[model samples]
Target: MSSMTKIADIEAEIARTQKNKATMAHLCALKARLAQLKRDLIASETKKGGPKGDGFDVQKTGDARIGFIGFPSVGKSTLLNKMTDTFSEVAAYEFTTLTCVPGIVAYRGAKLQMLDLPGIIEGAKDGKGRGRQVIAVARTCSLILIVLDVAKPLQHKLIIERELDGFGIRLNQEPPNIVLKKKDRGGMNIASTCPLTQLDADTIKTILSEYRINNCDIMFKGDYNADQLIDVIEGNRVYIPAVYVLNKIDQISIEELDIVARIPHNCPISAHHDWNLDGLLECIWDHLNFVRLYTKPRGQVPDYNEPVILKKTPQPTVESFCSRIHRQMMKKFKYAWVWGSSVKHQPQRVGKDHLLDDEDVLQIVKKV
Candidate 1:
């Protein structure tokens, strides 16, 4: 049978299975099998030239990339037009924006690339409505802005989360604090630093066994469950921060808007009326966690007009800063003089390993 067919059968069986201690092992194995099948289906489709169309292959530019994802006619085009001043075809009907539209916005001295992706429908992760293609592009983004209509936000939000989850995209989450290392002779050695309330010995073994992992060392640094274990084992998941942009707030009442705003990591706005867009932009900036650094010459003043942008991850250090400016600069590397919150003195001389803070001034001192 085809992979999709097998997946469907397993899913049906899983849904029918009872949830209890006795059935936990079976359920874990079933879920792992389902995940593997889906991965295989996507891999096979990729080998056969997966979804392709015009405007799908957008060239990535700017300090960071943000993709606008939601169902059709949710004010995505209007948001893009207003925020980035880029023209995206807007209309009253659904699926009006059928292709990926790219726009650039300069925020806090950092240029962010915004993409108005095609409307994603339910069953998107299952490759329905060419969603596989749309989400594939989304996976490349540093942040995903899930634009939703203020009306019926919760239902659509859950569906979109599920779709992204199925595609191995973990939204607003960090990678599970779990590690798996293969060993030749030793059998499955499982260890946990904290009390794992959701996962037991049997469940862990069942999940590992499903992947034919006979010998391995598993360590859980934090309390996690079976699904997290599976995600770690799969090793294909991408953890991305997402903001739910509740657009068309002008149509909703004040009380209704208050409830919508209560949703965690959400920003309510009316794209057409240009209401509360500043708040949305600020929310996006915070989620992005971009650090801006200025370069200082030996004698000249620091240039603030064009600042270097770095991600908060991997720890932005002077070494990375040098590499960002020029790959060859590291060869003659010595140290950097800093003037910002990262240092105590006005311009403390620090080594390349020194971590940099936002808006910090850096002046590299190379070897003689």
Candidate 2:
């Protein structure tokens, strides 16, 4: 039978199986099997051509790329047009914005690329209505702005989250503190720093056995569950930061707005009335965690106009800063002078390997 057919069978079984101590093992095994089948299906599809698509391939620019994702007519186009120079068509109807519309949001001396993507349907993750292609674009983004209308059902938020989840995109979450080291003959050694309440020793063992991980060292630093463990083992998950842009607050009452405001990591604004966008921009900036390096000359003052923006991941250092400025600057590197929060004293000298802080001033001194 085909992978999809097998997957459907396993899913049906899982749905029928009740959750209890008596049937936990069977449920876990079935879930693991379903996961493997999905992985196989993705692998097969990737070998054919991958999930990428035409017109979805936009040139990434600015300090970071942010994708706007939501269902039909969710004020994504309106927000994009208000936030950036790029003019995306805005209409009252659904699915008006059919393609990826690119724009640039210049904020606090930092330029951020904003993409108003096409409206995603419920089954978009299953290759419906350019959903796979849209999510593929989101996978490449540093942050996702989940735009939603306050007038619509709040369940739409869960639906979008589910769609992104199926694509291995873990939003607003960090990678689980779990490690799996393969071994030839040492057998399975398990270790944990925290008390795992949700997952038991047997469940973990059953999961590992299901994946044919006969000999490996498993380490857990957090109290993560089986699904998270599966994600870590699968090793294809993308943990991207996301914020819920709750748009159309102008259409709602003050009491209703209070309810939307209570949602965690969300910003409620009215794109039509241009309300509370500043707060949204600030939230986006904080979520991005961009490192800004001001260029300083030997004698002249720092040029505050253009700052070298670097991503916080992989530990941003002076070497990364130089690479962003010029490719060959690192080879002729002597040392760097730093000013701001990264230094102990005023203008402390640092080397190529020195890590940088956000909004720090840097002066590169090369060898003769």
Candidate 3:
């Protein structure tokens, strides 16, 4: 039988099966089998589809990238036209955008590349109708803007999230504070600084064994669950920040608009009428978590125009800044002088190891 047929059979059986305390292990095994069958089905479909010409993949540019994803007829193309200079075809029909239409959004001295991607259907993650290609493009983006029609029910957001989730895109989530290190001889060593309420020892071993992992060290710095253990085993998951942009607010009532605005990371706006788009852009900027730094000469004023923007990290020291300018500067660098939130005193002489903060002024003096 075909892979789809087999998958359907397994799913049907799983649905028919009942749950009980004694049948938990049986259910787990069946679930694992179902997961394997689904993976096999997806693999077959992807291989049959071969290289697709959905034609949306484009070269990434600008300081950061924002990928637009949603079902068709949700004003994604129109929103792209309004927000950026790109002229994506907008029509009163489905699939007007057949390829990737890229545009630049220059805001606050930071240039953000916004891509208008083709609308995805329900099964896009399963290599259906360029879904894989579109999501692959999204995997590279700094942020995913899930555009939704306010006229429609809000549940569509969950559907879109499920598709992204199946493709290993964990939106608005951090990498789990769990680490799994492989070893040769040790059976399994589990360590935790905090109590783990979401998982137990037996469940952890079951998950590890399902992945054919025999010996490893599992460390949990924070709370985690069984799915997280699977995620750690999968190791191909991408955790990205996502924003839910509610479009077509002009069609809704003012009272309805207030309710939409209350949603987390949600911006209610009209893409057609350009209402509250500035607020949407501001939301995008904040979610990016950008760090902008200015550079100064030894005795001259700092250049405020061309600031070096970097992602925020735990230790954003001078080495991180120097590597951006030139890698060789690290060896020839003597010390750096900082004058901003990262420093205690004004114009403090610091080394390459000195951590930097946003808007910090830096001047590097090289060795003679």
Q: Highest TM-score: give the candidate number.
A: 1
Q: Please list the C-alpha lDDT of all candidates, in the order they appear.
A: 0.92, 0.88, 0.83
Please give, for residues 114-169, the per-residue lDDT of candidate 3 as tens digits. 99999998888766787888887898999999999897637778788988987779
lDDT sort, best first? 1, 2, 3
Per-residue lDDT of model 2, residues 1-368, tens digit only? 98878977998998898898777777888878878877787677778886465568899988889999999898999999998888999987888987899999888789899999999999887778888889888999999999988877378889999999988999989899999998888778889998988788788889889999989999999999888999988999999999999998878899988887777889998899999999999999989988788999999999998998887776799999999999988999999999989889889999888888888999889899
Pairs with steric clashes in candidate 2: none
On residues 21-91, what C-alpha lDDT tens digit does candidate 1 reach at each position? 99999999999999999999888888999549999999989898999999989989999999987899999
Off by over 4 Å in 1: none
- 2 against 3, candidate with superior TM-score: 2
**What is the Cα-based TM-score of model 1?**
0.98
lDDT of 3 at 107: 82
The C-alpha stretches of model 3 lying farther than 4 A from their native spots are 1-49
